[model samples]
Target: MLTYTPPIAEQRFVLQNIVKVDELSGHNVFADVTSDLVDAILEGAGQFAAGEFAPLNRVGDEVGSKWSPEGVTTPPGFKEAYGAYVEGGWGTLTGPTEYGGQGLPLSLSSVVMEDLGSANMAFSLIMMLSPAAVEALKHHGTEEQRRTWMPKLVTGEWNGTMNLTEPQAGSDVGALKTRAVPQGDGTYRIKGQKIFITFGEHDLTDNIVHLVLARTPDAPEGTRGISLFLVPKFRLNDDGTPGEFNDVRCVSIEHKMGIHASPTCVMSYGDRDDCVGWLVGEEQGGMRAMFTMMNNARLNVGLQGVSIAERATQAATRYARERVQSAKAGSASRESVRIIEHADVRRMLLRMKALTQAARALAYYAAGLTDRGQLGDADAQARVDLLTPLVKAYGTDVGVEVTSLGVQVHGGMGYIEETGAAQHYRDARISPIYEGTNGIQAADLVGRKLGLEGGAVLASLLSDMRAGAAGEAPLMALIEDCEAVAGHLATSSTDDRMAAAYPFLTLLSVAVCGWLMALQLRAAEREDGDSRFLAMKKAAARFYLDQVVPETRGLRAAAMAPAESLFGLDEEAFSA
Candidate 1:
C-alpha cells in the first residue's frame, strides 16, 4: 500500500514565503480572504484528501470504472466520495457567489486542488472540470443560461465537460467538423462526434453539461469557423430539472494505460436528429469564449503534473527508507542496509525531490499571478500572461520527468502493478499532451508571449529578473543567461526568426525555473536553524542550477540554428 502524506509544511512555505498569501489579502478584491482563512481551508482540504480520497486511489485502479450499454459506472466508493466532496462544498470554492459558490480566490482553490490531485488525480479530475465549465458560462453565457444551470453546476449536483476533439481533429481546432445549424427558435441542432472527452459520461451527477465547440453553416473556414455551444445530456425543463434525454450518447470509452477510474469517452452528439444546444457568446466567437476555460484548464493541468510528481516522490522516498538491500561498504556482518543508504538510490531520490519542489514553486507562482491579475495592480495582468505558458508547459514537462524518475527509483517493484508508482507515471503522461500540447505551448510562448506589447513583456520580465537578483552570484548568472537568449531573439532577422524562437522558448523556460529556484533558496537562507525543509529547498535549488540550468545552452543553440535542418530532412531516408 502507498503511504501518502500531503507536504503541508512545504505547501505553507510556498504560500507564505514564496507567493505571500498575506500580501494578496491586502488587495480590495481579496479583502475577505485572509491568511488565517487560507490556512484553515488548506488544513480542511488536506484532511479530507487523506481521509476520503487517498484510500480509494488503489481501489480505483484495481476495480476501475466499468462500461456497459446501460451507462458508465465509477469504481466503488467514488459515488460516496463525490457526495462527501459536494457536501463539503469543495466543488464550489471557485464558482461565482451568485451561483451558490463560496467565491474563493483562484489561488486558494489552486492549493486545495493540488491536495486533491495529490490524493487521487483520477477522482479529482471529475471535480476539476466542473468549475472550468462554470467559469466559461459565467464569462460568456446569457442571463437565462446562468440562471438555469449555474446553481446546479456550482453546487456540484451536475458536472461539466468540454467537447472539442474529433476522430481526425485532435489539438487542431481548425480541422474540427462538428456542425451546428441555427433553428430560428433560439436553439441550434448539433451534429458531431467527440473523442477523448474526460468525464463525458459519469453516473456521479444527475446530469452532464457539455460545452461543445462546432461550426455554423455560414461560418468561416478553419479555426475561424469554430463556435462553442452548451449541450446538456438531458434537456432541462422550466423548473430546472432534467427532462427528456438529449441526443448525446457514449459510443465507447478508451482503455488507457492509467487513470482507469476517469472515463475517457467517445461521444456522439446528434446521432438522432434532435440533439439541441444553445449558443455560448456569439457565432465565430466560440474559440474566444473557450479560451477563458482553456487558459484556466491549462494551469490546473500543470498543477496536476506537480501533484502527481509530489505523490510519486513521497512514495519512492518512503519505500527507500524501509526497503533493505545489500550491506553498506566495510560492514562487519552481512546485515542488509536500507536502500536509501546506497549512493545511487540517494541521488535518484534527491533528483525526484528537487524536481518536484521546483515544479511546485513554478505552479504556485503561476497561480499567484492569476490572483494578482484578478485583484492586484493594473500592470500585473501582463506578468500573468507571460508566465501562463511557462507554468502550463514547463511544469507538466518536469512532472513527467520527475514521476518517471520515481518509478526508476523503485527498480522492478515500480514496474509491478501493485506498487502504484506506475500509475503516477501513467497519469502524468497525458498532462503534457492535453490542454494544448507542450509543443503548442512552446510555440505560443515564442509567437505570442514574447511578442506581447511589441516585446515589452519579455523585456519587462528580464528587467524584473535583474532587480530580483540584486547582483547575487547564482541569481546574476541566471539573469545573464536570460538576457543572452533574449538578445539573440531581438537581433534575429526574418529568415532565422522561427528557428531562433524554438530554442529561445526552451531556454526561457529553464531560466524562469532557475530564477524561481534561486528565490526559494534565498527564502530558505533567511529561515533560522537547520530545518530539513530549508535544507531540502537549498539542495534542490543547487541540483537544479547545476544539472538542469545547463540544458539552456543546448536549447539556445537549437533556437539559433537554421530551420532547414529540421525541415530539410529527407522523408525517404529513414526507409533504409
Candidate 2:
C-alpha cells in the first residue's frame, strides 16, 4: 500500500507564500481567517485523511462498492470514516456560517480536499459532490430550499449529487429527455433516468439530495427549456426527518477501471411516476443554474488531479530512494546503489515533483483568486474566469502525466496493483474525463473564456506573466506565443478555433504555470528556511522553467495548424 504523507509543509508554503492566503484576512468576509485557523485546518485535515482514509483505500479498491436492489454499499470502513469526517467538521470549512459552517475561505477547503483526495481519491468524491450542490442551492435555490437543505449538507449529515448525464445525453445536456411536470401543488413529478451519477445511491448517508436537470412539458426546445430540480432519495416529513421513499432508485453501479468505491450509478427516477421534486430556480433556466454547479465541480475536479499527482510523486520518490539497482556506470565500486542515484530515475523523480508542484500551484492560485473575486474584486473575477478552464484542463492533464510517470518509476512492481503506483495511474485517468472532458474544457477556454472582456482577460494574464517573468527569456517567448495564439483564436473561424482549442489550451496553461513557478522560485530563494526543503523548491521551480516550459513551443505550432487537416479526414480514416 502507498502511505500518503499529507505534504502539510508544501500546502502551508503555497497558501502563505504563493497564494498569500493571510492577506485575505483583511477583507470583512475573511476577517476571522487567521494564520492559526489555517494551520489548524491543514493539520486536522491531514490527520483525519491519513489515519482514517488512507488505510481503507486498498480494500475500497479490492472489494469495491457493492450493489444490491436496495442501494449501493460502499466498501468496509467507508461509512465510519465518512461519519468521522462529518463529526470533525471537515466538510463545513467553506459552508456559510449561518448554516452551521465554519465560514472559512473556499481556498482553505481546497487545501483540505487536496490532502483527503491524496489519501483516498474514491472516498473524496463523496465529499466533493456535496459542495457543488451547496453552491447551486446558494446561488439559485429558493430561500426555503436553502433553509431545508444547506445545513444538513454543510454538516455532512446528508449527501448531495448532480444528476446531469443520461444514457443518450453525455456531453450534450440539451439532448436530455428527462421530463419534469408540474403537479399543481408547487412541486414537480420528475420522470427520467440518469447515468454516471457519482455517489448517486451510496449508503453513507440516509438521505441523498439530487440536483437533477429536467425539462418541463410545454417548455421551449433545447437547453433553454431545461429546468433544475431538487429531488431527494427520501422525502422529508413536516419535522424535516426522512419520511417516505421518493422513488429515486439506483438501477446499478458501474464496473470501473479505478476509484471503484465511488459509485457511478445508473439512476431511474419516477419509475412508479411518483418521484416528487421541487423546482430550483425558474423554469427554462436550468442551464444557468447548472453552470453554477458545474463550474464549481470543474475546479474541484482539477484539484483531484493535483491531489492524485502529489500522492504518486511521494510514492515514486520513496521507491526511488529505497529500491537498489545497478551501480553508477563510471564508478569503480561494484556495490549496488539506490535507483535514485541513477540519472534516468532521478530525471523521472524530478519531473514528477516539479509537475506536481506546478499543478498544485495552478489549483491554489485559482482558489485564491476565487476568494478575491468573492470579496468584490472585478479584475480578480475576470482572471478567475479565464483561469478556470486552464485549472480544470491543465491540472488534470498534469495529474495523469505525473501518475503515469509514478508507475514508470516503480518499474515492474508498479505494474502490479499491490504496490499502489498502478492504482494512482488508474485513479488519475478519470479526472481529465470527469466533471467535463478535458476536450470540453479546452473548447470552453478558447471559445468562450478567451473572449472575456473582449480578450482583455487573457491579455492581462499574459501581461502579468510577462512582467513577473523578470526577464526570463523562455517565459518571455512563451508569453509571446500565448499572445499570438490568442490573436489567432480571436480572428479564426469557428472550425479553426475548435481545431486549435486543445493545443492552444496546453500552450497557455504551461505559460501560466511557468510564470507561477518563476514567482515561486523567487520566493523560495528569498526565504530563510530548512536548506533541503527550500533547495528542493528552488530546484523544482528551475526544472519546470528550463524543461517543462519549452514544450509550449511545439504546442504553439500545433495550435495554429490549419483546421483542414482535421476536417479533411473522413469518418473512415479514423476507423483504422
Candidate 3:
C-alpha cells in the first residue's frame, strides 16, 4: 500500500510565519477563525485524510469507478468515506455562513485542501468542484438560486460539476455548440453532448448540480453567444426535495490514464427533450460566470500538483533510507549502506524537498492573498489575479517534474505497478492539461493579466517582490531580470509576446517562489523552533535559491527570443 504523511507542520509554519494569517484578526468576517480554531481544523482534516482517504487511494486506482444504466458506482469505501466527510463538516469550511458552512478564511481552506490532495488526489476531486461552484453561485447566481442550492452543495450531501467542454470544443470553449432553448416558462430545454465531465455521474451523493455552458437561439456567434445554465440530475420539488427524473444521462465514461477513480462522463442531455435547465447570470454571460469558478478551480488544480509532489517526496525519502545499496565512495568498509548516504541520492532527495516546499509556499501565498481579497483588499485581489496563472502552470509543471523524480529514486521497483510510484506520475500528467492548459495560462498571463489597470498590477507585484527580498541577492537579481523582460514586452510585437507567454509564466513563477522562500528563510532565522526543523527550512531555501532560482535566467532568454525563432521552420521543412 502507498503511504503518505500529511505535512501539517510545514503548513502551520507557512500559515503563522509567511502568511501571517493572524493579522486578519481585525476583519469581522474572519473573527471566528482564530489561530487555535484553524489549527484544530487542520489537525482534524489531517487525521481524516490519513485514516480514511489514504487507504482508498490504491483501491480506487485498481478498481476505478464502474458505470451502468443506474448511474456510477464508485470503488469500495468511497460512498462511506464521502458520508463521513460531510458528517465531519469538511466540505463547509469556507462556505457562506447563511448556508451550512462554517465561514472560515480561504487560507485555512487551502491548508486543509493540501492534506486532502496528498491523501488521495482522485478522491478529493469528487468534492473539489463544489467549492468552486459555491464561489460561482455566491458571485453570480440569483438570490433564490443561492437559497435553493447552496445549502446542499455546501454541506457535501450533493456534489457540483462544471460542464464546459464538448466533443469539438476542448479548450476552445467559444466553439461549443450545445443549445439551451427557452421554453417560455422561465426554464430552458438543454440539448448537447458534453465530454470530460469529472464526477458527472457518481454514487457518492444523492444529487448532482451541473453548471452547463450552451448557446441560446438568436444569440451571437462564438463566445458572445454562450450562456450558463443550471441543470440538475434530478429536478427539485416544491418542498426542495428531488422530484422529477431529469433527461440528463451519462452516455459513457472515458478510460483515462490517471485519476481513473474520477468518473469523467460523456453526458447527453435532452435525449427525449426533457432536460429542464435554468439560466444563470444573464444571456451571453456564460464565459464571465464560468470564469468565476474556473479561476478558483485553477488554483485548486495547482494545489493538486503540490500535494502529489509532497506525497512523492515522502515516499522517495522513506525508500531511500530503507533501501540499502553499495557503500558510499571511499568508505572504510565494503558493507552495504542506506541509499540516502550516497551523495547523488541525497541530492535527489533535497531537490524533491526543495521543489515541493517552494511550490507549496507559492500556493499558500496565493491562497492567503485570496483570503485577503475576500476581506475587501483591492490590492490583494489584484495580486491574486497576477498569481493565479503562475500558481496553476508552474505548480502543476513542477508536480509532473517532482513525481518523475520519485520514479527515478525507486530504480526498478518504481516501474512495477504494485509499488505505486508510477501512479503518482500518471496522475500528475493530467494536471498540466486540465483547468485551462498551462499554455493558455501562460498566454493569459502575458496578454491579459500583465495589462490590468494599465500594467499597474504587474508593476505593483514586482515592487512587492522587491520589498520581500530586499537583502536576498539571488531573489533580488531574478526580480530585476523579470522587471526588465516585462518592460520589454510593452514594445514587443503580439507574436513576440505570445511566443514568450509560457516561458514568462514559468519565469515569474520561479522568481516569485524564490521570493517566498527568501521570506521564509528570514522568518525561520529569527523565530524559535526545533533547531533541526529551522535549519532544514533554511537549507531548503538555500537549495532553491542556488539551484531552482537560476532557471529564471534561461526563462528570460527564451521569453525574449525573437518571434521568428518558432516560425522559421515552416510548413515544408518540418516533416522532411
Q: By lDDT, who's the top model here?
A: 2
Q: How do all the candidates rank in terms of lDDT, highest first?
A: 2, 3, 1
Cα TM-score per model: 0.95, 0.99, 0.98
lDDT of 3 by residue, 203-234 (tens): 88878999999999988989889999999999
In candidate 1, what are the lDDT values of residues 330-361, reduced to their tens digit? 77878899999988888898888877887788
Give the count of colliding residue pairs in each prediction: 0, 0, 0
Regions of model 2 farther than 4 Å from truth:
none
Clashing pairs in 2: none
- Give each model's whole-structure lDDT: 0.83, 0.91, 0.89
In angstroms, how far off is 576's CA in candidate 3? 2.5
Best by TM-score: 2
lDDT of 2 by residue, 63-95 (tens): 999899978899999999999999899999889
Runs in model 3 lying further than 4 Å from the true structure: none
